[model samples]
Target: MKQEKGAEGFSENYWLENYADVDDMDGMYNARDHAHYLKAVFALDQIAIRSIADFGFGPGHLFSAALDTFKPYRSLGLEPSASAFIKAQTVLKRYQPQLLQTDLASWCRDSSQHKRFDLGICTSVLQYLNDQELAAVIPTLALRVKYLYLTVPTAAEQQRFVEEYQFVDQYAYSRTRQQYRELLSPHFTVVSSRLLESKQFYNDQTSDFTEDLFRF
Candidate 1:
């Protein structure tokens, strides 16, 4: 494993145990809803995607959806937590035989075995990392993928979550659309961006906004 700032600060089991409890985890601030993401995949021409990668692929929801819909040539999932990776592995068994588990920064550095991808998706993940970590990770992700799909929290909502959730460093940072472009422009062309008024129907009365989706 490549060394990282406080790389050993948090244990993977802790995250898995905590995330297993939905109430303890940040639920309201989820990424694009499963159904809507599926719609986005269906609209894409099947032939366009050959290989795909999902960074911080939580619970394998997006990964499963991609495999089910696109049937891409290959799908790779990268996760930091052991517990999350275990669950993701169980859910993504159809592709498990080919799955690779490693830290994104370290993996990207090793070009010999780990190669760049055709498409990369990071949903509801980047908003959780601080500016420094994002700076380190996003650029590498950009270099590794020809196309990238990212989901981020709305400015106002992210602020609210940071205050309400009382997260120390992670989830306290948010970036604007322009900032995203600036970060990725050096490595990729901004293909498109759309503000999705993500509606989370939690028993109808309890609905919330996720964020915008930036496709590069």
Candidate 2:
């Protein structure tokens, strides 16, 4: 039944049993190593992020790191699993980030932040959303963000993950990188390495960000 809602199979035990050492084991923290690299990207651009939103911040590692690293003045974190949300709260005690134990749709309905975030993190999140939710979220995020960091494994990548990376997630939708890009292109410019620039921030003439060419 929960999967029917959006393949939300997470719980406190799911987080506790699956995650370790902030990017080890069953791949929580949205792969923290990847999150760590973003600091360099943000610094290269000299972006002073004033606001941030983290969707599905499992175990709170990435969001906590973002709070300390970027020091955004306004922040919100959302997790659909109530049990995981409660457990993750322990890690976030030092920061007063607004948190909601709700899925993206619910949060979207209730959010009053008219001002767009300077950065948004939705890593490992979109693949769990069904088609309807995906359709809604892509454009909505474009309107609400300047830049976004997101990740959703393609089927081929998941094959490698299961075999070698110790990864396990039954909820992710099977889609290639190309398929995902088709949905995002109207709303965002898919930048390098799981990063995206919302149409609000994309410029046709500027290649001022990272020079690394994006690949599948």
Best by TM-score: 2
TM-score per candidate: 0.64, 0.82
lDDT of each: 0.56, 0.73
Query: lDDT winner among the candidates?
Result: 2
Q: What value of lDDT does candidate 1 attain over all alpha carbons?
A: 0.56
Residue pairs clashing in model 2 are none
Q: Positional deviation of 54 in candidate 2, in angstroms? A: 0.3
Q: 43-99, model 2: which lDDT tens digit per residue? A: 776756788888888778778887777778898888888776887799877888889
Error of 1 at 19 (Å): 4.1
List the pairs of residues colliding in candidate 1: none
**Residue lDDT tens for model 1, 1-216:** 212232222365445433544543432233335424544653553325577778777678666776665677776887765666777787788765255556656555666745656667776666556566667876667556655666667566666655997533342355776786576555554434432111111111331222223333
TM-score of 1: 0.64
Q: Candidate 2: misplaced stretches above 4 Å?
A: 1-35, 165-168, 205-216
